[model samples]
Target: MRRIGFLGCGKIGKALVRHIAEREDMAVEFIQDPGFINDIGVQCPVLAKADEAAFAGADLIVECATAQVLSENLELILAHCDLMMFSVTAFGDPDFERRAKALCGTYGRTIFIPHGAILGLDGIFDGGPVWRQVTVETVKSPSSLGRQDNRRSVVYEGPTREACVHFPRNVNVHAAVALAGIGFDRTISRIISDPEVSTNAHRISLSGDGISITLDISSYAAGAVTGAYTPYSACGSLDRALGNGAGLRFV
Candidate 1:
């Protein structure tokens, strides 16, 4: 059984905890959430600070927390165990990204970034150096975009790095797309606020050597800033990490 440690207990974290709790091959060792004082019904210890000593025994440390959580404990967490990152937008900072990658290499720990709220990643990744350009356009309601806009508007238009900074909570899909295809700088990210749209929609367009591909996915809202499909993606990523032997993996 894999002993898992949680770095956050928000929507995605809570969902992952519940999913892992039901599995026979995994156990939630400890959870680090500042607001969580009570058990919260999970059979695990909750800590205010996700220190290295607390997660020393964990087989994998899943970070469903913010980019700040990742930045603050980069060395400590990597020194402890492998990391499953949800806030992948943190890598937008070149310095931070380089440091984190170095730490993972030095510590012999893997950092896994899930395909959160997007599609066609396998194809995009496989497309390789041939990928000339990739663009991700995300449409969401104003409320979900974490702002108040009365009419349809383009909230942001720039590289994935800047987009992640402006809309960290909303545009992780862009970060995932950036990582899967061309890097943060070359990858374009556009965020639209449309009052007409009830569900969150993501469109990824890629132009490569011999192929031009586009994929559109719409996810119903579970929260103002989150979709119902995100938790399942996170769980699927975890399942692959845990492994089930010789089965064909789906990227």
Candidate 2:
């Protein structure tokens, strides 16, 4: 993220500002957030939208916006530089994913998907071919899942592709899991809105003829949608993506 910029200035974006504030490199160049006003307590200027100058200087743009926002601005953003894509749920649509990949090629740009809140992506990518099935069950607070239910309930259950369409903001980890392992349609995703849970949790189960693995990860976050540890994860991902020579990197 050389002279980086941010597409959204929400919790994750603001937290990332603080995370990399002291770094000599990877300093914030511009922030594009419509609702953002008042001092952000950072040295960077806030823009409602980035123009040519802002995009020209920025080698990478970190998108903390919603899936819809990414889809809307995909071409314009890619035209300038690489993108650290957080709204990976946008790729749940097979056509959108294909178009995004094609655009990356056309513009000579890259898109890096950071390891968000969940863990074990490395294992999934490695074990995918031989594994017979992969399933992930994610449990989050009702509010986190954008629900107001008084009782715990299963909000979504089915293939990862459809789950992303239903819960674009919440079930991104499921999308990540699907992308890392099997394709979106092949991976099973279950999202439960549990009023009893205070944290966002994921229970991933993988099985094959000779190997079986179960992985669980949870995070008590500062915001409803993003996990507390995500800022650090993004920072690490930015470092990994920048260090790689060219094209996209999954970190």
Candidate 3:
């Protein structure tokens, strides 16, 4: 069985553990969460520290924690095992991405980025040497916006790199689009807060090589918290990763 280590025990990490536990080919061996060590119980090894020993026997480490956790634990994780990061938005930091890539090369391991909450990637990659333009509009209820309540508003619009830097918490979708199409600087993103919309919506459009594609997806809040649907969609990407010839490609 393929041994896996998880770097967070939040909704997505818990979902991944549940998913892997049911699979015949993979088993979660280690779980790390600073916030909730006892929540998952003895079903798996739980650790408070991020270190090679914590990840000792795992074949792969999945990071579903915040970008801060990722930035701090990354070197240790990469040193011990191959890594799959759900927080791809952190890569928008050019310095961090460059250093991480170099470290991965030095450690002779691979880093995988899940699609998370973006679409039309296959089409974008299919058309190589392509130029991509994207606009991301998010519609969420006032409660979903947290403490500050606005009736409806456009919060941000700019290059994906800047958006990722300014809104690290919301970078997954934008980062996914940026990595899949052009680099972060080339991808356009817009964030909107709409009280009228009950669900989260993502719309993507790409035109290149005589092909134009558009994808619009709306997902209801799966759990009590906001941003629940993104991780559920990320689960789909994980499924694709484990399937043969099922990996996503533009072509």
Candidate 4:
């Protein structure tokens, strides 16, 4: 059985942990959340400090918290166990990304990034070096766009680097697409705030090597910045990470 630790008790964390707990092959060992209380209702030890002792027996740590948390407790967490990261926007920093990869290499621990709130990553990944251009257009409600507007608006446009900075938590799907298909600077991202749109939508367009691909996915919005399908996406990623011992693998 896999012993899993959680780094947040918020919406995505709670949802992911709950799903993991329901699985017979996994055990929720510890949770680190400063604002956590009994109200979280998960049967696990909660820690205020993310120290080595806190994650002593944890085989894996899933971070559903802010990118700040990833940067803050990275070394200590990596020293203890492999990590499943939901806050992948933190990798927008070249130094942090390089350092994290180096640390994972040094410690022989894997860092997993889920394809959250999007689809068709496998096709993009399989396309490889042939990719000429990848563009992602994300549309959400005004509230999710962090704006109070009555009309539709184009909130942001540029590379993934600036997009992540402007909408850190909201543009994780963009970062995932960039990491999977093209480099951050090369991947163009456009964020739209549509007052009439009731769902979160993503349009991924790629062109290269005599192939033109476009994938559009829409999911009901959970909040201004979150889609209902995100939790399920995280779970799917987790299932892929924990492979069957003898079954055919499909990823």
The alpha-carbon deviation from the true structure for residue 89 of candidate 4, after best TM-score superposition, in angstroms, is: 0.9
Candidates in descending TM-score order:
1, 4, 2, 3
lDDT tens string, model 2, 133-217? 9898988888887789889898888999999988999988889989988879989999888888788888988888799999988
List model 4 lDDT by residue over 131-190, tens digit each: 999999998988887788788888899999889888888888888888888878999999
Ranking by lDDT: 1, 4, 2, 3
In order, candidate lDDTs are 0.84, 0.83, 0.72, 0.84
lDDT of 3 by residue, 32-150 (tens): 88676555443876778756776778888888877878888888888878888887778898887997999999999888777665555665555546654655655555555452544
Better model by TM-score: candidate 2 vs candidate 4: 4
Candidate 1 segments exceeding 4 Å error: 37-40, 245-249
Instruction: Write out the backbone clash pairs for model 1.
Output: none
In angstroms, the error of model 4 at 50 is 1.8
TM-score of 4: 0.93
Tens digits of per-residue lDDT, candidate 1, 1-251, equal 88999888787888888888788889999988887644458878888896667779898888887898878988888898988989988988888889998998899999988887876677777785888988999999988987778899998988999998898888888888888778999999999998888888998989977888889999888336778788888888888877744668785
- Give the runs in model 3 whose Cα sits over 4 Å from its true position: 37-42, 142-147, 222-233, 239-251
Candidate 2 error regions (>4 Å): 37-39, 244-251
**Residue-level lDDT for 221 in candidate 2:** 57
Model 1 score (lDDT): 0.84
Candidate 4 lDDT score relative to the true structure: 0.84
How does residue 54 of candidate 4 score in lDDT?
69
TM-score-wise, the better of 1 and 3 is: 1
